[model samples]
Structure formats: C-alpha cells, structure tokens
Target: MKKLIGIDLGGTTIKFAILTENGEVQQKWSIETDISNNGRNIVPNIIESIKYHLEIYGLSREDIIGIGMGSPGSVDLENGTVIGAYNLNWESLQPVKEQIENGTGIPFFIDNDANVASLGEQWIGAGKGSNNVVFVTLGTGVGGGIIAEGKLVHGVGAAGEIGHINVDPNGYTCTCGNIGCLETVASATGIVRLARDMSEQYAGESKLKYLIDDGQQVTAKIVMDQAKENDPLAIKVLDKFNFYLGLACGNIANVLHPETIVLGGGVSAAGQILINGVDHYFQKYTFPQIRNSTKIKFAELGNDAGIIGAASLVKRQS
Candidate 1:
C-alpha cells in the first residue's frame, strides 16, 4: 500500500510523520531544525532525515504517494517558494518545492503552517465534519486559517491572516508594523503584557503584583492560573484579552459565518475558562443570527495538527 509523508517545519524543530492515506498516523518523529547558513542546511537535512526513515521502514520513494509540508511565511504555491521567512533566516525566496522534489524524487506539497493546522482540524479534530471552519492560534504570536465549503481559502496567498486584524487602533504596535493587531492583545505575550500593565495601575491587593515583585516570571499560564484562583489583577487582564478575542471572532463571523471557530495554541490550554470568557463578549458583538449559528471550540489536535494537516494536503488531492 502507498504511504503518505507529513512534515511540519518550525524554527526550532521539524516534525515528521508517516501516515496512511486515510489520515492515520503510522509513525512520527522530529529533528532539530538546522537554521545555520541562511537556512541552506534546512532542506538538505530534511531530505537526509526522510531518507534515513525510509530506509528504516523498508520503504522506497515509489512506495510513498507524496510528501506534504507546513512552513512559515507567505507561500507562493505556484512556484513552491516561501518569502519573508525571517525566523528561518530565509531572507530571499526559498524554492522549497523545487529542492524537496529534486531531493526526494517525489511530488511535494506545502502550505502555510497555520493553514495546514486548520486543514488537520477540519479532517479529524475540532473542525471535523464541518464544511466551513475558522481556526485561530494564540501562542507567542497569533496565526489563523479559514476553510469554507470544505476547502482552504488562499486568496492571493494571504487570505487567512487573522492575527493582523486591527482590534484596537490605539493599541500597541505589532511586529508586523501595525497598531493593535489581534496578536498584540490576544496572544500569550499579549496576555503577559496586559498583566504587567494592569498590575502597575491596580491599587488593590493582587498576587499577580506580588509575584512580579517577587521576580517570578509572569506568563500567560500564570495569569490564567491566577484568574482561576480569583486573582483580581489576573481576572482583569483575562477579561481584556477575551474582549478583544471575542470582538475579532464576532467580526469574522459576520463576514464568513463559519460553522465553527476553533481556538488553538498554548494560550488556548486555559480550556473552558478561556472559551467562556471569550463567549461572553462574542455574544455581545455578534449578530443574533450569526451568534446563534457559530460555535467556538478548542482545538483537539494540539501540536499534531501540523503533521496531520500537511498529510491531508496530499490526501485532499488524492
């Protein structure tokens, strides 16, 4: 039987998986990303790793249907090149598709990492069974993907940029050179920033303030945990985060009216509290019809979404 290969390329690690065409994983592993020399070594290392794994599994290039990869940056699908992947030190357009196809002698496919994750969710996770879905990832930075009518939307190759949505015109500057992008207020770093700002202005007793004074590294997790314990400062910051996140969702729903909006990433691990918090404001801004139709849920696949989603690229075409 033919097998499928999935790769999720990140700044730190490259996750790999061998899967059946049906989206079932047979084996999975990872390697540290060799981002040295302007990321020149990255593709070579991936080819070598895949070759080694193929040997171990007693499989050859012909036995695999295709290889799929999820990468960072703006992807040129027609050319299979990624642009502005600064984190990978890829200063210029990298011919990821050409290089991988040449090295592996197999068809290769690639998409934006976040978009691939959305495909993964839609295949077998939170967005399963939904023809239209939106996925928002709130981590160190925010990322997003949109699927409609059971297909990924890639309008001009920049369609699913949910992070860059301006939530606060007067909010802090985002790395993307924008003011108050959702990433600045809804991401993990954003949450911590909110905590620090609120603590300084807060006059009441706050364990969050005490922790900061004690030199404890205050993280988004800490903020959520503190809120769970009813810390006033933490609660205020979380409420703020939810407010922006909900507003973004409300606006997105008004346009797409997707069947579901799935939240993923490390910050989403706050679970029900995060969902409930966002839902409160989500209900306020959304139109009554859209509000009643859309549902916000947490991602089920977690980190694996990348691998599965990449593989689904090939599965989708097959």
Candidate 2:
C-alpha cells in the first residue's frame, strides 16, 4: 500500500503523521519548534524528524509515495518557496520542496497551513461531501481558507486572509499592522483581550474579575467558563464577540455564499456556547434570504486537520 507523510509546522510545535491514501493516520509524532534560539535550525529539525519517523516505522523510501507540509507562512506553492513566515522568522527561503527532497529523498509539496486545513476538512472531516466551504480557525489569531468549486483559492500567496479583513474600523490594532482586523477582535487572544478590558471596566464582582486578579492571565476558556456559569459580564463579552463574528460571517456569506462555514481552533471548543452566540447574531445581521442557506458548523478535525490535510495534498497533486 502506498503511504504518505504530512507535516504541519507551527511557531511552537511541529506535528507530523504517516497516513494511507484514505486519510487514516497510521502513525504520528511531534517535536518542539524551538524558535527561541534561532529560526535557522527549523529545516534541519524537520529533516531529522522525518528520518526518525521513517526509521521507527522501518519503512523504505519505496513505501512512501510523497510528502506534504502545511507551513505557517506565505508560500509560493508553484515554486515551492516560503516567501515569508512571520512566526517562523523566515524570509525568501527558496525551493523548500527541493531542499526537503534532498534531505529525505522524497518529493514534497507545501502550502499555507490554513488552506491545507480546509482541504483536509473537505476530504475527510466536516467538509466531506461539500463542494464549496469556508473554514475559519479562531485561535490565538484568526486564520481562514476558502474553497470554491472544489478548488483551493490561492490568490497572491494565499490572499484569502479572512482574518485580516477590516471588520472594525475603530477596533484594536492587529499584528499585521492593521486596525480593527477581524483577528483583533474575534480570535481566541482577542476574546481574552476583550475579557480583560471588560474585567477592568466592570470590576465590581464579576466571575471574570476573580479569574484574573490584575487582568494578567485571561484566556478564552476562562471567559467561556464564566459565561457558561451565567456571569453577566462574561456573557457581555461573548455577545460582543458573536456580534462581530456574525458581521464577519455575513460579509463572507454575501461574497462566497458557501454551503457551509466551518469553525475550528481552541475557542471553537466552547461548543454550543460559541455556536449559539454566533448563530444568534448571524441570524440578526446576515441577509435574510441567504442566512437560511448558509450553515455554520464546527470543524471536527481539531489539531490533526493540518497534517491530515497536508497528507491529502499528495493525492490532489497526483
């Protein structure tokens, strides 16, 4: 049976997996990214990990059909160059495919992690059977991928950056040097930031305030927990988040009219709380005619989505 390898590279962790053609993960492993010292060592570390996996599985080169990677940066898929990876501190790394092939003797392909994730969902996850779908991941930062007509849209180096779309002209500043980007107010970190601001403003006797004495360590999960317990302040925070999320989704729906919108990332773990909140506002904000057609659902792949998706890319290429 032909096997494939998938690699998902993040700022803090590198996840890899071996899988069959049908997306079943035969084996998996991970390693710390160790970007603290220097980002230059990442390629070597990745190569070593691949070697380790191959050795452990006792698989020869013939057993592996191809390798695919979902990298956290702007990638030139046609040329296999990582133009820029802000989190990885990489710039203009040319021919990543050739480099990896030289190291592992396996042909490799690469693309933006978010785009690959959407593809993964479409192939074997929540997006299965859907030809058109939009995936939004609300993590420390928000990331998105667009799939239309059964093809991944890659305009100008993964230009489907839905998170960077200006949702609030007067909102907080984003890491991308933009003000009021969707990620600034709708991401997991954004939720925590909003909760902190609210906790400070409403410091009377809220559960959120108790979670953070000085508002130093607020997290999305904490805020969700407080809201789930019916804390007024926490509910207000979620209300605001959902309002913006609805607005963003409304915008997306207007443009793409996707069959389904898949939500993933840590914040999505809030389950029905997040869904209900978004759904409530989406109904109120979106175009009445289209609202009923667009269905919003949570992504089922979780962290494994990237690797699974990356591995699945081999099939697309073949």
Candidate 3:
C-alpha cells in the first residue's frame, strides 16, 4: 500500500496530511506559517514539520511515493516555482519544487490552493464521481476551480478565476483592481459591506447596527443569522449576495456546462439559505436546459478538501 504526502500552504497556516493511494487520510496536522524574512522561513518550517511527523509515525521519505503541494498564488507546474503569492508576501518567484524535493528526496507536484481544494471535493466529496465540476469557495475573497471534461481547466495555469468575473460595472473595486467583480458582491467581506451600507441607508434599527454600535466588526454570519430570522435589512443584503453569486454560477453553467457547482468556504457556512438563494438566481440566469441539469450543492470535504485534493495531484500523474 503506497502512501503519499499532501500539503496545503495558506497565508496563516500550513496543513499537511499522509494519505493512502485511494484518498483516505491516514494522518493530518498543521503548523503556523512563518512569513518572516519575506516568507523565507515558510518552506523550511514545512519541511521540518514533515520530517518530525515522519519520524513520529516511524516512516521514511522512501515510504511516500510522492508529495503534492497547494500554494496560494500563481505556480508553474512544470518547473515548480511559485510566481507570486500575494497573501504569503512572496515578492518574487520561489523555486519551491527544488527546495521541497531536495529536502525530502521524493517526487513533488503543486497547484493553486483553490484548484487543489476543488479537485479534493470532486474526488471524495460533493462532486464525487463527477468528472466535470466547478468549485467556488466564498471566503474573505472568492476563489474558484473548474474541471471540464475530466480535466482541470488550466488556461496558462491561471484559469478558474470565477470570483474576478466582472459581474457589476459600477460595483465596488476588488483587490485585483477590477470594479464589480463577482467577488465584491459574493464574498464574506462583500456580504458584510453590503449589510453595513444598507443599514446606514435605512432609518429603522437592525441587529447589524447593534454590532456597529458596540464597535464589533460586522460579519457575514451576523447578516445570515438575521436573514434567517426574517430581518428585512439582512435579507436585503443576502439577496444582493445571492443575486451576484447565482449570476456567477449561471455564467459558469452557460460556459462550461459542468455537472455540479459545489460551494464551500466561510460564507457558505450560511448553508441552506445560501444555496437556496443562489440556486434561485442560477436557475433564472442559466440556459433553460443547463439550469435544470446542473446540480448545485455544498462541498462535503470542508477543511480536508485541501489535503485530499493535493494528494490527487500525484494520483492524477500516475
């Protein structure tokens, strides 16, 4: 039974897992991301941790057939260099493949974190058994991954940017300098921004206003909770979010015609309300036949998706 190692590198934390060839997680752990010295310590720390865990489990690098890493930026799969990871503060491209492979004496592969997670879900979660799936993760910012015709769509290795799609011409400017991208209206930050703005416009009292009055940062969870209870202002904000998200999904359906659109990330914590709302608009905006055929659902793999997806990279190569 050959085993593999999976790594998910994020801005704050780096998660790792040991898994069987069939995608079962045998063991998993995480470590804080050390971005000091312009993130010089990040990769080294990961390498050390992997060594420590291997010793604890009484296994050697030779026991692992390969390693798959998911990082948060543009990566060149062929060369294993991260072009840029904004949140990780990688100022320039790093020879990530050389460093990791030299340290572990194992074959390694890499991909964008979002795309890795999408592959994870398709392998063992909501999109299981579906060769074509589009995964959208609605976190602080939106991230997307698309699988078309049983292949991960990598247009110059930077495709599947669903969030940056220009959904509104006059909407708020995104971090990417795009105005009114789907991310601006469908992400957790976007949800809070919409709720805060709407609360100010309305004269009546609202739960979100209480959070504002108390000096607490407004959160998407707060808005979703209030919306579930029928708060007029919160519902309005959610409607705006759902409209844009659904519109995005509809656009994806029209273009890729994927079998499933799996939603994940923090804002997706809203669960049924979030999916139901998005589904309504997705149905309205997608082509009539596509609208009915495409299944919209929640991601089943949550945090584990990263590791599962990373391991799939090795499986894919095999």
Candidate 4:
C-alpha cells in the first residue's frame, strides 16, 4: 500500500511520520532542527530524515504517495517558500519545496504549522465531522488556524496570524512588534506576566506570593493549578487570560462564524477550567446567533496534530 509522509518542522525539532490517507499514523520520529547556517540545514536534514525512514521501511520514493509539511511563518504556497521565519533565523524566503522535492524526488505540499494543526484536529480530533473550525493554540505564544467551507483559507500569505490580532492598544509590545496582540495577553508568557503583575498589585493574599516569597519560580501551570483550588489572585489572572482569548474568539465569530473553536497548546492543559472560562467570556462578547452556534472544546491530537494535519494535505488530494 502506498503511504504519505508528514513532517512538522519547528525551530527546535523536526517531527516526521508515515501515515495512511485517512490520517492514521503508521510510524513517527523526530530530529533536532539544525538552525546553524541560518537554518540552511533544516530542509536538507528533513529530506535526509525522510529518506532514512523510507530505507528503514524497505520502501523507496516511488512507493510513497506524496509529502505534506507544516512549517512556521508565512508560506508562499505558489513557490513553496517560507518568508520571515524568525524562530528559524530565516532571513528571507526559504525554498523548502524545491529543496525537499529535489532531494527526495517526491511532491511536497506545505502550509503554516498552526493551520495544519487545525486541519489535523478537523480531520480526526476535536473538530471531526465539522467543516467550519477555528483552532487557537495558547503555547509559549498564541497562534491559530481557520478552516471555512471545508477548505483552509490562505488569505494572501498571512491568513491565520491570530496571535497578532490587536487586543490592547496600550498593552506591551509583542514579539511581532505589535502592541497588545492577543499573544501578549493570552499566551503562556502572557499568563505568567498576568500572574506576576497581579501578584504585585495584590501581593498579600495569593498563592503566587507564597511561591514568589519562597523563591519558587512561578509558571502558568502553577497559576492555573492554584486557580483550580480557588486561589483568588490566580482566578483573577485567569480571568484576564480568558477575557482576551474570548474576545479574540468573539472577533473571529463575526468574521467567520465557525462551527467549532478548539483550544490547544501547553496553556490549554489547564483543561475544563480553561475552556469554561474562555467559553463564558466568548458567549458574553460574541453575537447572540454566533454565541448559540459555536462550540468551544479541547484539541484532542496533542503532539500528533501537526503530523496528522500535514498528512491530511495528501489525503485531500487523494
């Protein structure tokens, strides 16, 4: 049986997999992304990794159907190049498609990582059986993807930069050089900042204070855990996180009115508490019709999402 290759390329690691057309994983592995030489090694490393796996399985390029790749930054699908991937130290358009295709002799399709992850969820996870889906990832930074009318919307080359949506005019500057982007207030960094800032203002009655007083490093997880136990300050901080996130969701609802909004990433590990809070605020801010139609839920694929979503690229064509 012919199989497809799915690759999730990140700044730190490059995850690879072989999958069936139905988005089922067969085998998976990862390798350190060599960011040396200004990320010049990344594409070559990916090609070699895929070939290595093919050899291991006693299969050749002809036995594979195609390749699907999820990458960071704005992707020029027409030419298959990545533009401005700062995390990878990529200064200009990186010719990912040409390199991989030249080296492996396989047709490769690429899309933004967050977009693919969203596609992955829609394919076999939380958003299954739905065509209109929005996936928001609250990780070290916030990112998201949108699928509408049973298709991914590329809207120029920068469609799904959800993290950069302006939420606060007076808020701190985001890594993207924008002030008050959703990522500034709704990401892991944002959560920690909220906890610390709130702790400073109400320094006396918070578990975070105890942690700070004892020199214990406070993290987003610690804050959420404390909030789950009814810590006042932690609850306050989470309120801020949910407010911005929900506000973003409301804004998206007006634009797309997606059927499902799935939350993923490390911050989402806070679970029901996180989803419930965001859902509360989302309903509060969104239109009545949108509020009644959209459902918020947890992303189910976890680390496999990127690969599975990438695989779906091939699945769609087949």
Best candidate according to lDDT: 1
Count: clashes, candidate 2 = 0
lDDT of 3 by residue, 100-137 (tens): 88987888999889999999999999999999999999
Q: Largest TM-score belongs to which candidate?
A: 1
Predicted candidate 1, C-alpha RMSD: 1.3
Ranking 2 against 3 by TM-score, winner: 3
Candidates' C-alpha lDDT: 0.93, 0.86, 0.90, 0.89
lDDT of 2 by residue, 135-214 (tens): 99998888889999888888765567889988889899999998999898888889988887777788567878777766
Model 1 earns a TM-score of 0.96
True-vs-predicted CA distance for residue 255, candidate 3, Å: 0.8
lDDT of 1 by residue, 32-106 (tens): 998889999999999999999999999999999999999998788778899888889988989998999999998
Please list the residue runs of candidate 2 whose C-alpha ends up more than 4 Å from where it truly belongs after superposition: 34-38, 92-94, 199-205, 210-216
Stretches of candidate 4 exceeding 4 Å from the true structure: 213-215
Per-model TM against the reference: 0.96, 0.91, 0.95, 0.94
Which 10-residue span in candidate 3 carries the lowest summed lDDT?
204-213
In model 2, which range of ten residues has the least summed lDDT?
34-43
lDDT score, residue 315, model 2?
Answer: 86
The candidate 4 region of ten consecutive residues with least summed lDDT is 203-212
